[model samples]
Target: MKKIFTLIATALMTVGANAQDAKFQIYTEVEPNTYAVTTNLDAVKAEFGEEKVTEAWGMGVWLPVDYVLIDNANLKATTAVDLTPIYFSGNKFTDMQKEFPAYTGYMNLGSSLGQNNWKGTEVIEDLTALKAAYHGAVSVFPKVDGTLSFGVYAGDNSRSIGIFNMATEDEMNEEIFMGAWANYYNFRHDGVEAAPDGTIPAKGSAAYVSAEVKAGRQYILVGGANKNLTMHQIKFVPAQGTGINNAGVSSEKTIEAVYTLGGIRTNGIGKGVNIVKYSDGTTVKIVK
Candidate 1:
């Protein structure tokens, strides 16, 4: 009996090894001017043998593995790239001017249809670089500076307010990125492994969405606009539900009390002008 069990285990192990070795198979024609292999036999080449395989992350996250595999092997693989337009007109422009009721020139948000689009992969490390890139792509206003809100268009009608404030602003930061807005979410390959969360219909031949990172250039969509769309400030205290949200809350939070300005309290006396206490033991106050 022991001998029979050993034999069965060895057979299973061999089968598993073969399956792993032959992961994914294909048979296709090599195309002209298409790069499927590289000339270098020395260096590691998961990227490319011809030109470098630039991985364009449309949603800024998620892997493009299937796309990379096909592009890597196909003889006539042409890269699919999309340029995202950055619009300059503020929807609230007319209101702001009305509030001031004086600065007559700030009324209209001049060029509306378009400002210009970037390839989404543009290296915009900060506001300065972002402004410079937008201008470099195409300059409409004399200066793409503050007082101007920014929005990005993803073809069709989908859009996201890229910037609310250029000065000390930092949109697309780490905090609300992965959860709130999965910007440019796309598949790594044309036919990547099926995902649990992918939009698979009953027929199993439908579109999908995933949040993994791989290689190659593919397009994904951001679900909704990022909150407030304001970037990071230079030196301001962090605001609630804005700064980096690292963990999830398991329980409900209850507010303890709210104090009237300059009013005395018996339970917990605060020395400031106004004070607020919460079940989480958090105190918000304005100190003179």
Candidate 2:
């Protein structure tokens, strides 16, 4: 009786350990491009060396002229795999550059109208161009099954953005509803006016949100609208092992048998490290 009780307790503990999830945060690694925090051009030029600031900006902008390219050499979230850059027609080639750390919302650069002069009719500038500076997208491909959580810079007003898990790149052609910080209808910039939406975060804070993601699927964070939204600190937390094979093959193969790490046959997955045998004769270790 005593031995049986001890075994049951051990099994419970093992299951708890196996159920633990791990979170990995991805950051923009390129020099002078910290995502979560905002910085000025002077600081960027100082840190990124003396290679003419405008020239550097031109190179960075021109490289991703057709599609979004994010450097992921320091990625530790899951099995590191090359992610394809996603392109959007809204992204236009112009002198306007998408500065890192801060996105000052889409503005009417051509109109010379300032945010402070929104009410004053000083020739209301065209603050309505759907420029890619505020409409860029980031793509993430995870080898492990997990959910995604990310933070976007939020100001006194609500900014619009979207998160989508797509099976193919072609699906990106469709539209996605704003997933976080939907637009605030009121004119409230610089904390002069109260945020119309109660859910809007305090001034200069990050609004964090979560989304479900599957293994081997392409997930994109799209700048859905011209609301001055900025993305940062994209993270993926593994939930459970999906049936993806070690060779990067995603399969829904039926389970034929299960066993413990020590090769002890088990009726079903219990705890600790589980050796799962698939109907196709492939075996994989799943923790859970």
Candidate 3:
């Protein structure tokens, strides 16, 4: 029995040795870009430069003089090659007096579609240096295989939001009905609000919407219609809770028993390495 157990453990170890531990990383820190509400002109000028500030004044108060670059310190952690300064394309204008999408705000912070209607506000993290068109929606390079979550706020008029990916920028165009979409409740205002009990409420404010994502791939998020929706935050995290195991085995199995390294049976997974036996006659080691 001892030799059999040793053989089982060794075989399992050999199979699990190549299993990559699950982890998650975001290209940029998830926070509200507050340039929309900034009131100090000098501070804005200091960060955005005097020339851009002057241009905004001449064009409009809410217009973007140029694309806003969002810096990412953890780019190399997820991406083998550093792709920093993700570009938030500014609102375009045909003439100095008229903005393409009326009431469109600057690109760095939050923006509104206004009458521009669903022209697809872009958030490009260009990995191929293609300098793709600015209307391809929310383009990002995910660092690991996980699910992308968007914390967003939308008024009553908000429409469906779609999530998908493309191999290269060449696949982007004005009309491409790619990926799946879901319409969620109108969670308006800044973010999820706290209830009277001080616990965070999940509805009627910014809420998390998830989509499937692959590691080292480019994904896009775009609104389905030209309506009132504002993205407050976005992030990615490892997917879990699926009915699968590290060895790619699929069985309707449940934990039958658990034992400590010292051969003592435990009620549940304790605070260290444990040997877990499943109903399917498979045993594996877990560390807490």
Candidate 4:
């Protein structure tokens, strides 16, 4: 019985070894630019029949393996190489100005696109060189009366870097002063008031119409005109239903409250009363 068991085990091991050494029959094509062989299973099936081809798998299409049946066979192989060169294209400021005339003046001045000056004068030969010469910078601006106000300047020449200031007087030297002023005016006018209870009341509430509140700070214009009024900050409370108590309580109880730092009396008024109050408790009213 021991002899019989030994014979059975030896037979199984021999079978496993034969299976491991079995070579898959495959048809190969030599690559034109490499010392590699590509197997075409479908072609092999058509030429040698499906039964003879058995199973087929691709080694690699570009650079396959070099098969050597004999140990003394001399076979050499090479890998794919990239020889492409990287090139850098500078900011096309001239093209931008010519193509978009309205924006051309600013683009040419180098105040609206990218950095004003590049460290290198030669065209960037690679990504590494371009990154070293040109990079972005981040700047922070404190809010005017707790309101964020920031500007960006981009240029290709030395004069491209425009002067920046926290105050309007400092911006006088800027060539685009008028444009900046207009932008600031638009931002100020678009502001909405906050409720006395420190919340943004409804659109028709006093808080919504009086002053614009953001974060924990409030803003109000002192003068009627943009140039006259310096932005001021104040604390605010949220005025909701029954939150505000003033004249005509029964008739205006539903309105919200928005208190300002200064009086509405000014040299030049724009449209409505600069000082706004919620006459109706549920609504906001602009009053001088």
Candidate 5:
């Protein structure tokens, strides 16, 4: 009996230890013009081979531009192989243009906007146009040596354009600053909250309320409507380390305000007040 009890306790302790050691992993898909680095130098060097790894700005990592080019080349080759069927089909230049916008756009430019016709007329024209556009828009910033480079280009008017360095795994784990950019949004650090459907609510409205987060949770201040059919200010002090408390005094205060202003109809002492119902199955309510 004593041995069995000891064995069970040991197994429980090991399970607890394993649970504590497990960390959350967040993965994001790589986007165009973006580069990522591993935190472990030895691991990175091993995967990339020592020759491909280099030191940039005192930090050792793989070459950013070269890495992007290599991946891009592989993608292009795969696409070309898959497109072999189109060559055999009775597809004309116009049909190809209709099928591939990017290819068509390039062809339009290569023909000098319909100026000169060349052999393999359509393909050459499209490629030439694409090359001109690529050269006009894309600029490469090479590091001191010829080993690494970063690409830059002008984005849409609403979006900001620039090169951004990424943080290595070690830097993220240690919270060390790795790189800087003019336009960066830290959604984790920012006080913005999303609705149940993951849509950001409008600012200054109950749908999208800003709150002070503490202990990995958010607290929002909900206000009640006033007598003049407008929303009145109500203090909502949320409980620490949890979301808004629907049954707290702060929620009651909002209910009272809304009832006084005729925004909500209530019955009985313990009944809740209905604020609004959304199509996404979320209900905003206040309770006593």
Candidate 6:
């Protein structure tokens, strides 16, 4: 009896260890101008408070552009990848030149509106033309149900997280800072909310009511004080109970059936929000 019990215990321990090891295996991808990284879905949700994560699909994780591209070079290929310079106000260009000195890069979509003004009214100076600054600058994330998001900045900066979508326009913000001098964005899923008054609700305000995040427009943020933040890394966390293969492979049948939350069947997977039904009658949610 004792020997049998020992064998069973050892089996259980090995299984537990294997599960833990699976989370550390981060997956990465690189397209023409975009790169991505993903880790264990469940692990990310656990960190973001599974309850606060909306009920859609995908996740967004932001790190400084420098960290992701130049400094730390978290992604192996980014160090060698050429970042086409997009001149912003001539200052960003001069600064880059001064910093790199001997650098001669390609001309891509450079913004004259300094990196610090990505969230400022200047971004919409020409209301008709919304020129998105894409100097490897990641802006405007999609808000879906069950998605997790976090922000990263340089020099340990802290500022308000202004939530903007088309429906509400740019009139609302979440003062996501605890106190002055705080560095990281305090992800507040409860209590703190956005209102039409163009201000964030105070902490512990029970009367605060905010709209649910919807599709058709972007859900982006504007920092309280521009910390000179540039988009870094973005994470796509799989929704809970979705049998998403962390290894990034699924059955052929699973890829065939794609549906939106509105029950409309799409010919194939489209960008943005998508809920997928699997062959085993199990449904999973995803975003592109």
TM-scores, all models, native as reference: 0.21, 0.38, 0.37, 0.13, 0.16, 0.28
* lDDT value for model 6: 0.29
lDDT of each: 0.21, 0.35, 0.35, 0.20, 0.20, 0.29
Task: Evaluate residue 30 in candidate 1 and report its C-alpha lDDT on the 0 to 100 scale.
Answer: 18
Q: lDDT tens string, model 5, 55-168? A: 321122322211121111101000100000101111122333343222211101011222111111121111112222111111122211111212111111111112123233
Superposition error at 69 for model 3 (Å)? 5.6
Candidate 4 Cα misplacement greater than 4 A, ranges = 1-170, 179-204, 207-288
Error of 4 at 133 (Å): 55
- Where model 5 places Cα greater than 4 Å from the true spot, the runs are 1-68, 71-158, 182-288
Candidate 1 deviant stretches above 4 angstroms: 1-114, 126-128, 131-160, 163-252, 260-275, 283-288
- RMSD of each predicted structure: 26.9, 18.8, 18.6, 37.2, 28.6, 21.9
| Residues 21-137 of candidate 4: C-alpha lDDT, one tens digit per residue | 212211111111111111233433443356543321221111111221101011111110111111111233233333222221110011122222212121211111111111211
Tell me how candidate 3 scores on lDDT: 0.35
Per-residue lDDT value at 128 in model 1: 20
Candidate 1 vs candidate 2, lDDT winner:
2
Model 2, span 1-288: residue lDDT tens = 011000100001111233222111112212221222112244334433446445444222111211212222111221111121111112221211332312311211111122221221121111122233313444455555666655554455544343444334233223232112211112222445344563544455545556666665655443324344444445555555543323112355577777664556689867554555566554444443
lDDT of 2: 0.35
Better candidate number, 4 or 6, judged by TM-score: 6
- Report the number of the highest-TM-score candidate: 2
Candidate 6 residue 149 C-alpha distance from true site, Å: 1.2
Please write out the lDDT profile of model 3 over residues 1-288, one tens digit for every residue: 011000100101211222222111112121221111111344344444677656554322232222211212111121111111122222221221131122122221122222222323333223222212222234545544566655433432233444435434333342243222321222223234555542233333433456667665555444433333444345444445432323212346677777764556789777754555666664544544
